[model samples]
Target: MNIDFTLEKYKTLCETISNSSYTTFTFEQYFNQENPPKNCILLRHDVDRNISNAHKMAMIEQRLNLVSTYYCRTTERVFKPEYFQEIAAMGHEIGYHYETLDKAKGDVEEAIKIFGQELNAFREFINIKTVCMHGNPFSPWLNSNIWNKYDFRDFGIIGEPYLSLDYKDVIYLTDTGRTWADKNIRVKDVIKDKDHQKNNLLIGNISTTDDIINLIKEEQYPRICLLAHPDRWHGHLIDWTGELILQNLKNIGKAGIIWYRKNKN
Candidate 1:
């Protein structure tokens, strides 16, 4: 049996989608396509802390003849121009995962300044057409708020999935807090657009990786943007066990933060 959240299970997830009627697209491909495929699943992988794992996932998709967008952070551990280049070489989309608002300590001007610099630094490696927000659960500032003062299109960014994608038409499912269905544990990785947020939550209480796979099998959602972190999945048994234990601790802390944020508001 493929362990949940392991690279093995991740491959199975990809196979399930491939075997189904659903067609998957990288975020950039989906946006640029004038006529998109039906029952599409936008494969969005957030490279939060691990590049090696992301590379493995990329290879799996490549072998399966699939493409997905990888939103990589500019953090010390995750940022590697060579890695980005290689991943993009596999016909995957390399996206900038920005958290400038928190990095600038909530100063919009400073945030935009940092954003330009970091984005350019990333572009030096790959042609970044799309971007995604790196929602730091510990940060008080919402990273996507940087768009309020400035427009992303001006910088040649075609889309910032959080603010740009119409959540109404696409079902957003993320493995935040190491699980799919826990609303209480997920803080910033959520859709703020009131118009679609209600409808998106209709995938009620999907708490496991299996639940998400099952949901896809049911064919209930026509379109889904599945956000998964590459760091959480491992191919080795030892690594998978380590991640399971480490992520459980993270889930507890995140749940506490969610509770505090609610009460503070």
Candidate 2:
């Protein structure tokens, strides 16, 4: 079988999305729409690390005339304004992937302060209208909790996919744990309602890229929000294999974390 998670596979996925009748929209575009089209796919990318790979993926989408939203972390390794600017210049949306709660170790005030500093830094280079929380499975603090104390819109933001999107209307799919369909290893990326309610929405049986392609072809879902991490998809063998091995270990840790939380409850 061919290797998955490579840029080649990602190109195939982009091609599939482009060939389908589904109209692609960024999160900002979706928020502005009062009545979205019959079939819509909100393409989102979490640029946790390996931002260079994100540029490559962004170019693929550009060539395919596909616009996507890239949520970036402000960590030293990930936050390069010029590289990200190139992406935004392609007409793609750049959003903040914030984890201030985890960074501030659960201090709401400190988290919001950090959030403001980083957001301003982003705005200096490009306009940011949307933000997504970086859900660290191992961290006990939920990043979105900062919003309870303050409003993200005050920062001139429009919406957040996790907090603002209604999962009941849009099915969420993420490439966490190096797999498209595994809630056992995913901690905070679960499909929950905007109220932080229980997981009321089901992601169906889709797992692999082929599964997503087939689903789009069949028109099974009217709306979808695909959350893919750029670091998870690579073009080089060394980087690809290294990420695979590391992610396998991380998945084991995540599964263990899930088990501990379940048993402790």
Candidate 3:
């Protein structure tokens, strides 16, 4: 396991911000700065954990004088009233991480019908104004198909960022493929820049956590979108490592299935 430059880069970025311009009072000004600071850390949490890694991550960010958004899933392994309230109290943004397609299992109508129920339920705990789709990595479908049928804003969601904008305007980064550049994974759904302005939409593959840290240091502050699975990042290294292993195994299985089908034909 060579050094994960992605994580190291992120750490460096955080440290640079802390030393050069970190302040309890200035935090507000920092984000609003017109020139932009070169890097904005969009720490996103896909709340899929059995334990409370989201809570711990929030605590860590708080210690660093940073705040992030946490998107909670409201299904099988989902949103609890107590957990929702706790995250809200931390003064962080709470949004929806939905998978109605998975819940509906390819039935578009069924997904929409259930989405209404889930949306109503989520409102009981928090006023969720924004949403992001839970990328069902194993599914052939990209984002939950239900999102394609209707406008989330009508359901009181301000935006589902991924579907709402072109990635070129703001760089799209995520912990997808267990590392950024999972070559086998081609995200066909998310819009990419066709103008060849790769720098503007720097969606490069990040193989290590250090990639994130490094970006925080070098780039000019551009609003970034990051996807993290709380279910994947357990506080302990052992648990985190195990989750990655399982994810890799699932990917392997998917590849094997593809290979078998190709040979059988």
Cα TM-score per model = 0.94, 0.94, 0.76
| Lowest lDDT 10-residue stretch of candidate 2 | 194-203
Candidate 1: tens digits of C-alpha lDDT, residues 1-265: 6467888888888888877888888888888877655699999999999999999999999988888999999998889999999999999999999998998999999999999999999988789989999988888899998888799998999888888677878888888867777467777887867757777667787777888879888998888889889988888888888888888888788889878777996
Model 1 scores worst on lDDT over the 10 consecutive residues at 192-201
Show where candidate 1 strays beyond 4 Å. 35-37
Instruction: Arrange candidates by TM-score, descending.
Output: 2, 1, 3
lDDT, each prediction: 0.86, 0.86, 0.60
TM-score of 2: 0.94
Off by over 4 Å in 2: 194-204
Clashes of 3: 25
- Candidate 2 local accuracy as lDDT? 0.86
- Per-model C-alpha RMSD: 1.7, 2.2, 5.0
Q: How far is candidate 2 from the true structure (C-alpha RMSD, Å)?
A: 2.2
